[model samples]
Target: MTERSYNSLLSTGRIAGLELSNRVFLPAMDMNLCVEGEISDGEIAHYTARAAGGTAMVITGTGAVAWPVGATSRHQPAFSDDRFIPGIRRLADSVHAAGGRLCMQLCHHGKTASVDTADGRPQLVPSLLEGGADMSALRDNPMDELMRLATATHGKKATYKVADEDDLAWVVDQFAAAARRVKAAGVDAIEIHAAHGYLLSSFLSRTYNKRDDRWGGSIENRARLTCEVVRAVKATVGREYPVIVRVNGHEYGAADGLTAAETAEAAAMIQAAGADAIHVSANAHNPFADFTDGPLPNTVAAYREHTKTIKRAVTIPVVAVGRMLPEVADEMIAAGECDFVSMGRQLLADPDLVNKIRAGERRSVRPCINCYVCVEQNFFDGNPKCAVNPALCNEKVAVLTPIARAQHVVVIGGGPGGMEAARVAATRGAKVTLIEKGGRLGGTMWFSQLTTPANAMLVDWLTHEIERLDVDVLTNTVADVELVASLRPDVVIVATGARRGRPAIPGAEMPHVLTGDGLRAVITGDADADLGSIGGLGRVAVGVGRAIGLLNDADRIRRLSKVWMPVGRRVVVIGGGLVGLELAEYLAERGRLVTVLEEGKHLGLPMAMPRRWTAVRKAAEHGVTLVREATPVSISKVAVRYRVGGDEFEVRGDSVVIASEVCADTSFADQLAARGLNVKVVGDAANVGYIEGAMHSAHEVAREL
Candidate 1:
């Protein structure tokens, strides 16, 4: 808790001649904040906010060394020409003015170049990679189809010719030129992107580099290209300037991927080539693998082992990244596993994470839930966005100034949206009162957290902020028109949330049938199990589950929730939406034979392609049966009957779950608006959406108030 205790992470350090105020660096993340090769005002504002948030160093994401030919994404920043220097210089000056150092990442997408954006030029690669599976390949499972679609649309495509000696020399020169441009821009340091299956990384790994020439086969030969680039960059930027190279510890998907041993050898070679530091990352070449930016749940801090291996191999400083929490990062530094710690999504979730940690207000720091919204947005050709932090990447809109006059505000429902509305309004000098019908502040989040425990962090943060900002929180208070009118509020925000609708199927009212929320409540002991005629065994399971819930350990409860849920040995879920599939997976993981029936053509239709792929894969891995185009007509004691493709089919399960749907219950909004009050609706109350939409709507309404 003391500054001295955080010496390893918060201590001042140097990279070559560049001095970093602290070891916390904002890892380079592609925000798609630029147009062509020029950094826009939005991009400058984005970096400026992070710098002002107390980042010691900020690495600008993926600036292309060669436009059109080597570009990865259409909107990635470009450093291919000297003409772009002025715009980057402005960014550098802004960050420096905020007392933070800036670094430019020079990249050549190489084999990863998008064919549509390559101006019909052949891509340069270490070797012409042989094609694997067909782009349109399909399998019996829905996950394969989703993965194929995600890969075809989201993954970059290119036609490549193996790089000859002349071509390699030209690329080296391009790297040198890009370094010079960055140096001229007044940037503090440069990072050579030799990782994440980029041009340089493609040469460093045997998976792509099969050439027999000076740059392929053995690890030494495969690493030659990276060494050359580092030398060229150092030479052009002058020996005193700092040069860092990013390398992957594991390619994740490649059959003979670059392992940690090979990666460490590559790092040693790069260090020997005069590089100042090694920025370690893992998982590329596989869309399904967690990329740290939006990591999979079980893979938290996934790349720490890689960083440790590389750090032990080389004398140069190593940067560790991979969904690292502040305390975890500090321990890693103190343990000498890595010299510097970088966080991408965490910084996006809370720009002031480093500042909060420094001030010993660690509880106030917002945690990234690893929902992958940030990475998903970028892959879909949108700017980076956070689910919990709606104002992220929109710093201008997030800026809050005090209102002219303080006014009374009423926030209905203590969900994320309502709580955020109260927090923002109260911060801007408003008398805020938040009313929750339940004893808890988090509304639906309390149920949702059972499926994903990470959400508890957001719930805790919002609750903490509401209390800290002095918002009058009234729990167990059923809000009504009469109660709201009695408060005499200037503005009323309805974030009362939505309700799940059970399907009108045969035998729906059977004691064994339950809504998704009802099942979760029974498992967590929020609802009485004895109310349902679920027999003695079910009652005992519910009792045990309630006991675990009383422990108040979200992670532990989430792990054993399925055991507490009083479902029969066989589980039948009547929907294939996000919640339905996740529930099916949870049940299947706990040894239940689960079948998911959905009328929709695909599962998780609203989710991003990559995330959907992961979800469907998870379902398959858990042996959860997914049946598309299936409409449930009846649920009996023995089985569930469904119509699929004009045929009736039945699957037996002990209990039927109506995970069918939810709709925005705007009854309160309609009622409050009828009273002639200045009313606003947010979160599920407005759109029946997720965290991102909820927070964005709340921020929008609160600012206006």
Candidate 2:
């Protein structure tokens, strides 16, 4: 925990002649905050927040070498002409004044350039990609999302112009010119993007580049385009200036995809071509399902091992790009695996991550949760915002300045939303008291950790913040009109969460049938198991375990579930919403024969696109039977009868769980409001946005009180 322990992480790093404050670099992430080629003030504020928060170097999202010609997204930053120099200069000045360096990423989104397609231009490609990415996963997206993605290109057709000898020369010159423009704008460094299925990366990919010319075949030949770009960039900026080339460490989901050995060879070739550093990244040959395996990976320390492979191949500094925790990055650097580490999504979740780690306040740093909420916005060309941190692109609105008068605040319920409100209110010099009827602070979110482990970090963080801010917390105490009136609270917030109703089916009250709440109670030991539902003497054993408080700890219960659980071996989940699908997947993974009956066509509708796609695919892989447009008829002791297409079907299951159809419950808030008390509803109690909605509503309400 001492400063000396993080010597390598906090140590000064040099890329060519440029000196960085530390080894932590903000990876290039497309925020879609710009307009055409112009950078917005909000965009500058976003980078300025991170730079000021203690990032050694902040890499700007991909700046198109030719705006609207080879641009992927309509809102991506552009440095193609001198007209955009002022915006780049402004960002550079702001970042430099904030005590951090600035690096601009030069990109040309070859075959996937949406702007080019919209503008009726033939996009330049190394060789026209034979087939497109697997887009079957997108079928799970809602109708609105599908339409938005379709019209994002403005209803234009795409055409390709294969790059010939003359075309290659033009591409190289464009990159050199862009590099010159960036240097004129006083940018500290330039990162040549040759990863993530971009223009140069396609040439680097052996499978994508099928030309039999000098620009194809061998790995060295296939890497020629990227190497030339690196050389041209180095020449344009001169030898003292930094030139970092980002290449894929490995390409996933392709038989002939670029491998680690190929990438190492490419890195060496790039270094020989006058590149000062290599930023190692991975790419998914298939963008839909394998995306989590690539550029914006969901795994912790995803590209850590790949960097070790590339580092051994090049004398130039190696930059590792993926999700790297502070401790893991430090250990990676200390072991001479990589020189710099990029924490992209983590920094977006909490800009002060570096400062927090530097101050030994790592516990206070907010977690990203890998929810992919931010990534969902890019499909619609909207600026990205964090699920937990509501003030990502709107930093000014996040000011926590104290109010003129101190007031008393009371928050009903101790869920994520309630606890967040309490934390924020207390921070703004208000007296906050949080009351919960349950014995534990976290509501259902604690049990949600059974399927989503990342959620635990969020609950832990909010609890820490609540305690740190000195908000009075009362567990096992109910919030009522009498109790709240006695406290004399100036403002009250109700975050009691959603309401659930069991399906109107025959034999709904059977002892073997459990509601979502019933399942939670049984798993957390908040409610004892029904003897009628349990087997002979095993029922007695479960009751004794609950009575003795052995099931109090969630982790212990999760561990015990693998060996023993009160639920039956076969499970039938009603309603294929987020809860039902996640529960189905979780149960299936635990060796249960699970079947989900959904009245609607979609599954995981409430989740983000990437996570939803993953959940559906994984559920299928785990052998979960999904029946759409199905209405439950009745629940027998052993089988569940349902109707799919006017035909009756019966599926045998030992236990049935109803986890569908949620509605907003504002009865408590309405009662408090009718009494003339300032009342606000947040989280699922107001709407069902899950964690993102909870955090957003909490921030909005807490800032006012």
Candidate 3:
């Protein structure tokens, strides 16, 4: 890579007269640190951390410009009252002190706002349609009266009144007044939140805006309200102060909503009406709109593509957003796709992303793997967290301060958990030794990298971190009881991971049968070649005769390509978890007739909701047969028998893959405990769960140590 200076991104780009020291922008994210609509110290610290991290501008969470019905949540911050000016001023001052600019994203929540009114009253929208409100809350309510109750609960019965033409004008004036107050508070910029299915977004979208008046008909008419708000903010703050608008490049709904082309025209209008820049996003109301759950790694490309259109239509700079990796962001800027990159979850994942990049310490920079857990927490868990970087939300409490009593530590695994523990311990000034039986550090991640490219990033990150921390890495050196005792570390982290539990099913012990891990090892050419030859099996049929019986057709082909197969084309996958589903899809893609026999009622039930839904949808689209509420009873050379609904059925298949149980091996921990060794267990060896749990547990154990 040719070395080039980032002087432009590092220096402030002028929007009217407001100056930002850099182009790094922290997009809006609800910190959920507000108490009764008042910004708490936690919220202040959260924004302050971003500013301190050297962000050029910090955009506060959606601050309601309109009162009552326009607010999304009771706890969401508001700019409607001057009482917030003091708090806002404090935030601005903190940002300014950190050499950063501060901006508030003014918003209105339309129909999707929480219906819990201040005085126990109802909510309101442009239309009083039932089931039109955000359906997330309805999942917990009873089905019988859910829609009716939601409609009634969301009806404006108290402070919120249906907005008429005059009401719309009044709301516009309110935004202008709020802008004036924010400018007075020393905020460098003001952003209009016209995206994410908020009130402004609803008007821009054809689905929410049903009014036949000038604010509802065509795309231009629907966008009139947002344009007016932008113009009002510009008028109030004067042309010297920067004012940006965030808009959805595309709304994913059946309604003939604004397309990227239409959104570009609207953005141009907003710019022409005095907006300084346009920030592009997608998926208006979806809680996981950050593109974490999407299949693509370059989520920002969607926005970047649309920003190109908007850039052509407008004179102002376009800000692109999505799941933008730092490298991708730099490319976008280099290519002139967007003048600025608006990062939300990525910044939350690693506030020091830009700082690390500037220092040429890319390895030290944590990567956002696009897990929607951050958004999921905000929408459901009520607290956002980054899976990779545990110090995200609780930064004030989780800084990388040196341990008071650093000691020698031995991590007995080379997987994600062990690697994380070793890295953290080494960083905290501990003498760390990481022992792995394998030659490489990543363990199962080696297999994961083949399945998903983004997972490769984790391996790279872990490898880089391990090298940076200078931990002693002993590859192909398994730590035995004698060896561990001889090392005599102050602490022992047992992250030996889990072993594939071979169930006592028929033919499970057959030489033809292999475990999923065994298959992956063989497929990746990392398996001991001697093992396959020692069994006197010329070429093992690496197909359905595998453990967990979840090797899909594609995986079978990949495996068989290494060891030729004379078996039939039929296959049966026994598990419906993420692994099983993925295998099934792989098999079906290769023209193999695949049947997934899941013991659970729902396929991929163990996966997170967002991931499970996407997996299930993909499985369905791939024509993979699903036999839920079924368990495999037996597997034979020509056929597999399973029971579903108390009925036994034999499905003929060329091979059977077992995708079921995995057991954690903690015998090492027991032995160490018996020997009076200080030991902490982590990852699958402690609890069989997702990568998030494993990484989190390892980090926690290291922190405690």
Ranking by TM-score: 2, 1, 3
Q: Model 2 lDDT vs. the true structure?
A: 0.86
Model 1 per-residue lDDT tens digits across residues 1-705? 343356677889888998898899898988887887689888888888889889999998787887655886667778788789899999999999988999988888887676333466667788776665332212223664445434412543445678899988988999998888889999999999988878898888888888898788889999998899898888888777989898887777577988888899888988999999998887555555333322232356778887888999999889988877877888998898998988888899988877887887787888887677777666545687888787777887767878679799999989889988998899899999999877676776766777767788889999888888999999878889999999999999999887777788778878788775567555555542133556577667666655655624556666665455567889899888877887788788778899999887777765555566677777888999999899888989989999998899999988888877777888888898899877999998788777767888898889878
Residue 552, candidate 1: Cα error in Å is 4.3
What is the C-alpha local distance difference test score of each model? Answer: 0.80, 0.86, 0.71
The segments of candidate 2 whose C-alpha lies over 4 angstroms from its true place after superposition are 1-5, 527-553
Which predicted model would earn the best TM-score? 2
TM agreement with the true structure for every prediction: 0.94, 0.97, 0.87
Candidate 1 lDDT for residue 517: 58
Clashes of 1: 0
Residue-wise C-alpha lDDT for candidate 3, range 237-342, written one tens digit per residue: 8877889899888765335756789898888788778898898876643433223322122344556677777777888888878777666777777777788887
Look at candidate 2 and tell me the lDDT of residue 257.
Answer: 92
Error of 1 at 570 (Å): 0.8
